[model samples]
Target: MAYSEKVIEHYTNPRNVGSFAKGEDNVGTGVVGAPECGDVMKLQLKINPENGVIEDAKFKTFGCGSAIASSSYVTELVKGKHIEEAMTIKNTVIVKELNLPPVKIHCSVLAEDAIKAAITDWKSHQTPASAQEPRKAQES
Candidate 1:
């Protein structure tokens, strides 16, 4: 099977490939694996709590060229996007961008899952806005 130029470009020179600190308050992480192909992907995001925008994104993928490209592409897509916007991203976008064949479509799906999982993990760490307000002193 031949790979598209975009796929080759990303596979050879993938971007945003690294990890944030394990427990940073603003960092969210997602790790997902594909059983059929034995591909594992880890995606992370550093979010700005004030505005819910992703400040940075990073990913590590262990699989074929398509999987790596998909992971690499999604990292770029999510950065600077709101968490809700990131959640709406679908695997089809990755497939189209990388020109992945039908068989490799699952790779894009894995990338999509990674994004949702990371967002979910981030939400888990957040408290309701009302809970953060300072308490006033009671009248004596």
Candidate 2:
């Protein structure tokens, strides 16, 4: 399959290609695998607790060029964005941005899934009372 120029650029020079220490408190990690193609990706985000903003991102992907490009692009997209805003990034946007063909759509889906998974993991680690107090107060 022919990749678009942007995809090639990202694939060739992927950004944030490393990992944080396992116990790093501010880091959130998401790992996803695509059984259809046996592709695996691990994505991580370092969030600012006070503002819920992503201060940094990293990824390791074992997949096709499209998958690598998708993950790389997503990391860049989410940096400096609030976690909720980052969650709004859809697979369609990745596909459009990467100019991925129909066959490569799944790669974009994996990227989106990875983002949500990381966010979920991050939320899970947060103190329940602290995480929920704002919402509870709003509802009451």
Candidate 3:
């Protein structure tokens, strides 16, 4: 398969390659698979609690160059973005950014889903205790 120079570069010298410590509340990780291409991607993220911003991101994708590039690029895209902002990330953006071919576009979508899942998990955890409970007092 033909890959872009940038894709090759990233695949050879990928950034943020390792996983963060487990049970770390601020860290989010996503693993996705594509049956057609037999591609599997694992992307991780570290978000800042105070601001709910993505402080760092890493990936351990076991797929082709496009999958690797998508995850790598998403990690870089979300480095300084707040969860709300990051949630707005679209697969189209990734596709356009990488100029991904039609057959390889699914990989980019998986990368985007990974980011969304991480953000969603973070938002769910952020619900205040009061919001989680409706009754504050005991009934007599």
Q: Tens digits of per-residue lDDT for model 3 on 22-41?
A: 65667766777888888887
* lDDT against the true structure, each candidate: 0.91, 0.91, 0.79
Cα lDDT of model 1 by residue, 1-140, tens digit? 99999999999999999998776778888999999999999999999989999999999999999999999999999999999999999999999999999999999999999999999877766767522432221101
Clashes of each: 0, 0, 0
User: Model 2 segments beyond 4 Å from truth?
Assistant: 128-140
Candidate 3 has its poorest 10 consecutive residues by lDDT at 131-140
Residue range 1-95, candidate 2, lDDT tens digits = 78999999999999999998875667888999999999999999999888999999999999999999999999999999999999889999999
40 Cα displacement, candidate 1 (Å): 0.3
Once model 1 is optimally superposed onto the true structure by TM-score, how far is the C-alpha of residue 80 displaced, in angstroms?
0.8
lDDT of 3: 0.79
Question: What is the lDDT for 40 in model 1?
Answer: 100
Off by over 4 Å in 1: 128-140
Pairs clashing in candidate 1?
none
Structure candidate 2, residue pairs in collision: none
